[model samples]
Each structure stands twice: as C-alpha cells, then as structure tokens.
Target: MTLLATHLVSRLRLKHLRLVDSLARSGNLHRVAVEMHMTQPAATKMLQDAEQLLGAQLFERRPRAMVLTEIGTFVADYAARLLRETDSFAEGLDNLKAGGFGALAIGAIMATTPGLLPRAIAELKQRRPLMTIRLIAATSDILLEALSRNEIALALGRLTEPKDALAFDIEPLATEELWIFTAADHPLASRESVSMAELARLPWVLQPHTSPMRRLIELTLARQGLGSLDNRVETTSIFATLHLVREAGMIACLPKSILVEGVARGTFARLPVALPNQLGPLGIITRKGETPSANAADFIDVLRSMTAPGEELG
Candidate 1:
C-alpha cells in the first residue's frame, strides 16, 4: 500500500473515527467533548493529532463553531458510515446471542391465512416483539415462485410440481380438506344428500384449471364419470368466488378453512357431497441448500409447535 493509505489503516482507531463522526454532527468541540465524556482540551488535542497524522487541516476554527475542510467532510462521512455499520454489527450479534430478533418474510397459501398462519404469527410476535414480519397471501404456485426468487424466506404451501421436490426442503405440516359450498338459498342447500351427477350439472364458481383445488375437483369428478365442468366461472380470488356463489347461485369447491365465516354468517351452506380425495399436505418450503435466517428459523419453530398438536390446516 501507499504511504498515506498505510498511515490511515495502521494509525486510525475507533476513538479517532468516533471523534470525527461526532464533530461532523455537532460542529462544536465542547459539545463533542461532553458527548464523548472527555474534556474540551482532550478533544481538541485528539482532533489535532488526527489532522497531524493525516498531514492536513481537518477543520477551520471560528469564533463560534468549527467548520470542516473539504477533505474533512469526506473523511468524516466515511467515519460516520463505519460507526453505523459497527453499531449494526454489534446489535445483530447481541440479537443472535439472545435468539430471534431480526426481520422475516414468509409466504402462505390462502388456506392458511384465516386461522393457521395467523395464530402462529401472533405467537411469534409475542415471543419477539421487535421482530419484523411480512406476510404474503397467495396460491401454492405463487408461493413457490416467491421462494425461487428469494422473495420469501420460506412458505406455507404445497409443492406445485414434481421438480419442486428437488429444489426445496419440505416438511409436511397438515392435509387440507376440500368442501363444496353454495348460497344458503340455493336449490341444493337444504338437501340431505346430493348426487355427484346432479351437482355436476349445476353452474359452478371454480378456481383456474392450474390451481391444485381445481385439479382435485376435476380429477374427482372424472373418477365419478362426470367428464368435465361446462358451466363454470373461473376465478382465483376468494372474494370473487364467494360473491359468485352467493349472488349468482353458483356452486364453489373451496378449502374448508376459508368458508368458516361465511358459513357462520349464513351466507354460504356446505353441501352433503363429500370429496373422495383429500388435497395434498401443506408444508414448509425453503431453499434446499441455504441455512434459514435466525428469524426464519424461530418463526418456523413457532409454526411447528402450533402444528404439533395434530392441528389440521385451517
């Protein structure tokens, strides 16, 4: 290294950096001295020593305040940055020692949003009030995509493709149940039992063909000799499906958890027809080779505890 660079790397110390950073903020020796718990003369001597070592005048002394020379501003700015980074490193180290005190971004399918994920998140927040959490509510495919892009640290959703098994680490959480819902006033609402043939003939509000729920419905119907749905409105939004089921008198096949409020409110009625196949197990998905962040690991622990009691996915 050059002589000047060697002098800086070898001689510059934390105290020198702190004093310059303080000077940049206060612009007065007396205040900087008081803040540093040092006398004014000591502070002045330190600054002079720094200037002499650097072979440059760092500040212009006036009657009232000290103004930074051009080079002093650059040096002080870098010193301030260094101090900030040092403080951040110290805080993160402390948090690591204490456990679970950082930011976490997680994604979940709509099925988990109503009950399962919320309870887990609330419990995590209670344990770590200073933690920052970002929740993304989306479909399983979308959640998987977020995981691939590193947009989320982990996901509570299904694996949409066979290849996902190779790319992500999965821990099965709970199996989701599919239910048929209709408006309370629909013709089939009061029936004790409905034949699959009869139900297949009715208008339906369904998710897109690509969604897992939709695929399950199609597969189940095909097994029952019902070829495919002809009269259906395709939607990915829960609100839109609910509206169509209630206002348009259409049948909707949705996760059991999402219909709790509507069923309680008398806006929706569950049909008597039972699906032969249960949906795939929902699980935690994270990048395969990477270690989870401290906050991610802690949040995952909270989620696992909630699911450990045989709590089915809501």
Candidate 2:
C-alpha cells in the first residue's frame, strides 16, 4: 500500500501540478502552456495524464476558458498545499546542508519598512549575505492572513487587536511612540506643545482607513473630543505621505523612527503634540508551535538583539 501511494504521488509530478494550477488560474490550456513554456499539445497531455491518474474529469471545457469541476477544485487546492509543503521541505534540507543559512518569506507593514526592518535586514545581510529574503509589504490584516496560511514565515508590525485572534505567537520587540509630523516651516512646528483639539484643524495626509495606524489615530482623536480629520488625501505610500507633509504642509501621524532622520536633518519637523497614549507595540509574529526555518530563526535572534538592550546571543 505504501509503495502504491508513493507511485501515485510520483506520477503527480511537479510539472503536472504546475500545469493544473496554471490552467486553473488562467482558465485556458493554451495560456497554461504559454506560461509553462511548453507547447499546447504537451500541456494537454499533462492535464490528461493528471485526470487519468485521479480517475475524474478535472475541468469543464468552455468557449473562452475552462472551469474547474467540484472535484477539480478540491484537487487543485490539495495540489497547491502539497507543492507548498514540498518546497518548504526542500528549503529546510538545503539550509541544513549550508550551515543554517536559507530562504525566508517575511511580511511587514509599510510602517516597519523605513526603520525597524531596514536595520534588521542590514544586520542579517552582514551575518549571512547570501541568505534569501522575500519581503511583502502589506497591512496587518493582510500580513496576518498570509502568516496564518503559511505563505510567510514571519511578520513584523504593530500588534493586531484582539478581534483578530489567530493561532499565532507574538513576541514584543519595541514600543514606539507615534508622532505628528509636518513640513519644517509649518506653523505648528514652532509650537512648544499643542493639544489634539488645536492640531485637528489642519488638513491631514492619512493612511488608508482600514489600516491599524489610521484606526489608532481616529480613536485617539475621538477620545480627545476632536472629530476625525477629513482625509482629503489618503495614501498607502509612506514615502508619498512624507513628501506631501514636507511639500504640501499637511499633517501626518507616523512612527517616531520613520521621521527621526528627517527631523534631525531639518527636512521635516516633529509636531509638539501632547500624545501620552500614542504608543504602539511592534513585534515578531509567527505560527504557534511551528519551528521556523534556520534563516528565519537566526534573523529573529538578530531582531531580538537589536530591539532588546543588553541581551547576549544564546
């Protein structure tokens, strides 16, 4: 029985899985062939072989595209999961052979990219220059979703709120105070301190409404009895937000680290806002009870060292 199972799995080659997945995604055999760099006849034969092995018709042929039958959907989903695990297993073996340096898939919020991530990545490069790092910049919701799906090994961002509970572990790194920033010459830049009520009157360059940062800002404003600033300009681009704050004299809330260099260099000025509760926790999140890749574990060690004071490497 084990031999029979091994033979069946071997027959479902990576090439066959690729053909099926490509067809499912593109919904056409010719397009799948084009994508796989194969001839149409070859692609068709691969699909036929896959269907014959499974003993079922995988897709219903349509005029413009093919639709997966119910069984086909199940097969495609299982095939994808198998391929992902296979790739991960291969990476693990390769890392074990190469002195523990391997590939890592990381997800980070846009806010982390400018500061924490850059510092961590620089350290990682110095430690293992050949290590492969794939970064996906996204919101916390998206990152958490990817992490849960095992598409990414680790994530660095603000801690997700309680409503987003999942089977993951969070390691606190640092608590960064969010600061209001504006162009150097803006009127509020010279103020010794300003209340939220006073600062709420200005035009703001806000993060997307769905973002955790935006939600934090809104909640803070509401608690201060100030209405949410109309987002006349909404953007997910942190760089663009900085430029707009510098050139357009608009207000933006961002992590202190993101604006520290600029504030020091006089490109932008940190507003003197009384924000006692404007701090957010940044952390590393990973799936609970799952061992990370060697490279990921090493990188996490570096991250902990960088964020923690007086911590010796174990």
Candidate 3:
C-alpha cells in the first residue's frame, strides 16, 4: 500500500488531524500548542508522531513560522471538513427527532447566487419544508474544495480549467458572460459606449487574484495593455462589490447573471463595453462516485427541473 493508504489504516486518529489543522491555521508551534492546551514540546512530539505515521513530514519548520507541506494541506482540509460535518451531524440527530430531514449544505459561485439558485431553493423549501438548507457562497475553486471534503452536498460553479473539473462529476448548466457593472449614478453609467481603456480609468473593485473571474480579467487586461489596474479593493463577495460600486462610484467586472436583478431594479447599470473571450460556463459539480443524502438528491432534482429546457443540465 502507498504511504497515504497505509496511514489511512487504524494508526491515524482524530487528534492527529486536529494537530494538523491547528498547525496549518496558526503556523506557529507555540501558538497552536497554547490553543490545543498542550506544551510546546508535547505539540512538537505529536506533530512528529503524525508525520511518522503518515511516512511524511506534514510541515516544514521555519525560523519564524511553520508552513504546511502539500500533504499537510490535504490533512488540514480533511480535518476542517471533518469538524464541520461532525457538528452538523450532531445537529442532524436532533432535527431527525423533530420530524426534520437531513441537511443539504450547498457551496456555490457568485454567478449562481441570484438567478439560478434562489428559485431552486424556494422550490425545495416549499416541497420539503422540514429539510435544513444551508449555503456557502464562494468562488468555484473554494466550492470544489468544500465539495471534495464532503463539506457540501452540492456545488454550482464554473469549471474554468481542465485540471480542477476532473475531481467532480460536472453537469453542464449554462454559459454566463462576464460584464462590467457600475452603480446607475456613476459617471460611466450614461456613456454611449465604453472601451477597456476607458473603464480602466475608473476606480474598480475586482475579484481575488485566485478566482477564475479575476484570471479572465487579468488575461483581458494583459491583452488590452491595462496591466496593474488601479484597484480600490479585491474581494470574493459579490455583495461587497455591489456595495462598493453603488456607494463609492466604483466599477466591477462580474458575472452578468448576478448583476441582472440589480440592473432590473435600477440599482446598478451594465456598461456598454464589449469584452472578448470572457464567457464562462456555469454548471453543477457533484461528488464523484458518491450518492448524496435523499433531500440533497431531491434538491439536485429541483435544480435540474428549474433550469429552462435548453439550459437544463444532463
């Protein structure tokens, strides 16, 4: 058996994962030891034991702070997820006794937040009022990681690249285009048309560097000779971007679907600029080779049914 496989035997315990999680989160042995209510030496020995059990060093000891090895990241990821699920499972028991079904925790990209998911959520609530529904809105990569750790039952996000999509069983939903949106009162709101150069001159709030949306914006900037944007802020929250754009007279390049409601409500306005090569496919990403809980499965069915006939995913 491989070292990872070997470590998955009866040798590993929950405490080992806790140690890994604490170390990853704190990145300082003394601090994490204090958090775990153990001496520094005991924490060090526990880390060493965990490394030995796994046949690999989970962290690299540095002068100032410790850093996780690649394997350590996996350990921490699973550890955090295990804790979340454990708490939810405890809640599940009480819910079950109260005539409630199991929970369906969903992780989704911002693009799905407004148009697709709300309708599906409403339908699920009406049909299964006893089901506990939870949501974690984040970028696609974050959603994928959560799904992988079984932290979430379903994900609605984009598969921007080839490598990341392989981990999930993705069902094609619909293609959504990115748009440059601003508050209706902004100066650019009344422009007949705008170009990348013109929009780049305005204050902006962009997505985090790691997000696919930001990646696309970066690529577009590079092509348009707008490197090193005058970014006012960087965030993963669409709501935050909306707030900034509305109050601060800033611009945002985000999914068209997310901005539609705001535009229809006259809170935000889409710029007339044309973006090349900025289309993203939105889809449903489920755990590979695993079945979700019955309510979650039913929610998935609701999502599929809610999609318009052509946009319906397989």
lDDT tens digits by residue: candidate 1, 1-314: 99889978899888998999899888899999999999999999999989888888889898888999999998887787677657655665675677647667799988888888889999998988877677888788888877776667899988877998899988888877778989999989999989879988889988778778888889889998887889999877888988898899999988889987788898899998888887778988999998988778988898888785345765
Clash total of candidate 1: 0
Writing each residue's lDDT as its tens digit, candidate 2 over 95-128 gives 7588666678899876567666888999998988
Better of 1 and 2 by lDDT: 1
Give the residue spans of candidate 3 off by over 4 A.
1-8, 28-78, 81-85, 225-228, 309-314
- Top candidate (lDDT): 1
Judged by TM-score relative to the true structure, which candidate is superior, 2 or 3? 3
In candidate 2, which residue ranges exceed 4 Å CA deviation?
1-11, 41-100, 110-116, 161-165, 187-203, 221-234, 272-280, 309-314
lDDT-based ranking: 1, 3, 2
